[model samples]
Target: MSDAVQSVTIVEVGPRDGFQSVGPFIPTPHKIALIGRLHAAGLRRMETTSFVSPSALPQMADAAEIVAATDRLAGLDAQVLVPTARHAERAFAAGATHLSAVLSVSERHNMGNVRRTPMESVADYAQMVAMMPAGAAMRLNLATAFDCPHVGRIGADAVLALLDPLVAATADVEIALCDTTGRADPAQVRALFAAARDRFPEVRGWAFHGHDTYGLGAANVLAAWDVGIRVFDASVAGLGGCPFAPGATGNVATEDLVWMFDHMGVASGIDLDRLVDAARAVAELPGAQIGGRVRDALAARARKAAA
Candidate 1:
């Protein structure tokens, strides 16, 4: 690998994607503390919360508080996920400067997720760009871009068709292709990303969000990385699941991704030991469904060494 391709940025999504999946409500103070710990462990960018209906996602009811708390932390880019134009408005109003606007690529997933089609979501994206304040940044998260639980494999054409309008509208945008069901193979990931880069050379950057339901999270990430994607979304302790997509599991774990990169000589600037500590704390949360191999393996290794 060349000097340019030897590093990456891992955007922490545990505070939003991971926390929202838990049945029990984690206190706002606890959420704040975890985010602080994550930042201290060298995570500069994070998906802190989502601005949505409290009835729909009770866990994100404290979005404003989380944003305010993270704002106090210098050098931290706290990104909030907004599902609609209205939600984007609310997020910007709450002092969130970085917004992650999400909409699935699959028609079935889009309808089930936000009650709109892909084209309607594109319209909302335009509104989001218009309302975005000066100097603010936005990332377009194209969920279910690879494979959808409702409709099976989503072709590269379907993903590029949606991106054509969104990318044309703005010169400043980062795109993330999500493996919503964790069923995408490495070949599919490489093909879609390569095609996207070829089609839209003007896009600022590209990211990949993958889940580990079928144990291909690391493999898929490597595939995207090979194709020049530098940013990635990962949840701490592997805690996540799509509320709208049935049978989908948690996201790729932060520890697992970090370990993979560290061994491969790829710089992520994250402290793996401290990240494991944060993940262990998250795992202790009541009713939290955590998944990841590195945390448990490290703990076991420590025990064996002590014995």
Candidate 2:
């Protein structure tokens, strides 16, 4: 870890990203309660839900209700993913303080996932950013920033090119490099973050969304952390996968990351025990399986101590 990088922000995406991949639907109240528990655990940032069409992503059909029911932490910032302007409108109306949008660097994945070419999606994102409410913040997630499952081996230049228009637009936006298929390595993560930092100096915040497909998620995270990137995306109990990307798995686990940060002496302001309990509760939900080693290990330790 860099001496200059003292603390990192962990954005919990389990409620939205993690839960959406599971087959059966989680109840709206359950989702809200889960988020509430996360907030109580000292998590100040979370991705609550995605504002997508119900017919397309039935899992997220209750997005509006979840947002409305989630209790806002005093200083917490909540974000909702939006694929289009209409999604943004609904998300903003539903009381989301932050809006997240995605544009894949791979043309094929962009078209396949969002039904628009990469270029078209970029233009659409720019339009949405411009139309955002005055006080609302926005972030652009560059999905498949590393290797694309469909197109394979997306170059750093290609990733930077996609960011060009967004940079020029001069909107208040942050960029998160997403390992959509969980295929990124340490070298790829370093190179991408270095390239993004060099290209877009105005981009205030840098985040990484890594998948555990190859079990390189934590290693890649360490690589980014060494390079001054702080904000990271993780899911509770490791719940989530990309429906479009076959063989993909949930993101890096929130409890695992919190444990790592605690051991590293990095301040995350999150209570690991509370987060672990929340993860266990989430795991018990239908269609959700627990996925973090720390949570499981801690549970074992508790049982042994009791015995």
Candidate 3:
């Protein structure tokens, strides 16, 4: 607990990561409506959609439409995930102002997720930088930076090695270390983030993306926050999991993090009540694999109050 740190940025990924794993096709308008609710709750940054192959992720087939709607949101940093160079190009064409490019540090996972070695993905990212429009931002999501499904645990050296070329290739890009399998412990999370900060002092923006499979999501986030990390990727209602990572569960819930930070006397600039309302709605979606405790607990409390 660094008492000096007071605020954090929560990048809502419910519309993208949360919806991608759902079996039922969420109507495009409904997706946009959820995004609207999130924005109203003061989520200034959001991963609104991904520009992947429509055949691969039919859920994201309407990426352009999602961006078109989110772009109008005042002060919203609407991020679109682009898994490949071709997808990155499509994102730019769709007028995406912020792009998230993900590459798994684990070779096996990278190959399975994007069919490319880590270095090859770095090469593609270099090209993505060349194609970046003026004033637009890019984030490098180092998936499985801490733990991988195929491989048990990834070493800090492996994560640093991958960052070497990635940081060299692009300047001023936010790098997020993702716990794709949600198996990383707090000690591991703290150590990796500390090493990364020391190794790459030039990379100003660092983010933590964690899942709650083993229920360490908020604890790991606290560890990272102790190490000075302020940006985090979380889904509303904990509505996300790596589709490529088996046995992995949903992301740490946005409302859970927000509630934790609020109780800790930290600011996230989000309205917890409104955010819970949004999460409650998302949790009701048919066949959706939702997770998180705060939403249901708060709902129960409200019910008790009414009773």
Report the C-alpha lDDT of model 3 over 264-290, residue by residue, as the tens digit: 889899999999999999988876787
TM-score versus the correct structure, for each prediction: 0.96, 0.94, 0.96
lDDT of each: 0.91, 0.84, 0.90
Q: Go through the candidates in order and give the C-alpha RMSD of each one to the true structure.
A: 1.7, 2.0, 1.7
Local accuracy of candidate 2 as per-residue lDDT tens digits, 106-172: 8888888889988888788877877887788888888989989887877999898888887776535
Regions of model 3 farther than 4 Å from truth: 1-5, 242-248
Residue 298 of model 2, lDDT score:
92
Order of models, best lDDT first? 1, 3, 2
Give the lDDT of residue 292 in candidate 1: 78
TM-score, candidate 1, is: 0.96
List model 1 lDDT by residue over 184-247, tens digit each.
9999999999999999999898999898888888899999988889899999999886554455
User: Regarding TM-score, does 2 or 3 come out ahead?
Assistant: 3
Q: What 10-residue stretch in candidate 3 is worst by lDDT? A: 241-250
Clash numbers, per candidate: 0, 0, 0
Global CA lDDT of candidate 2, please?
0.84
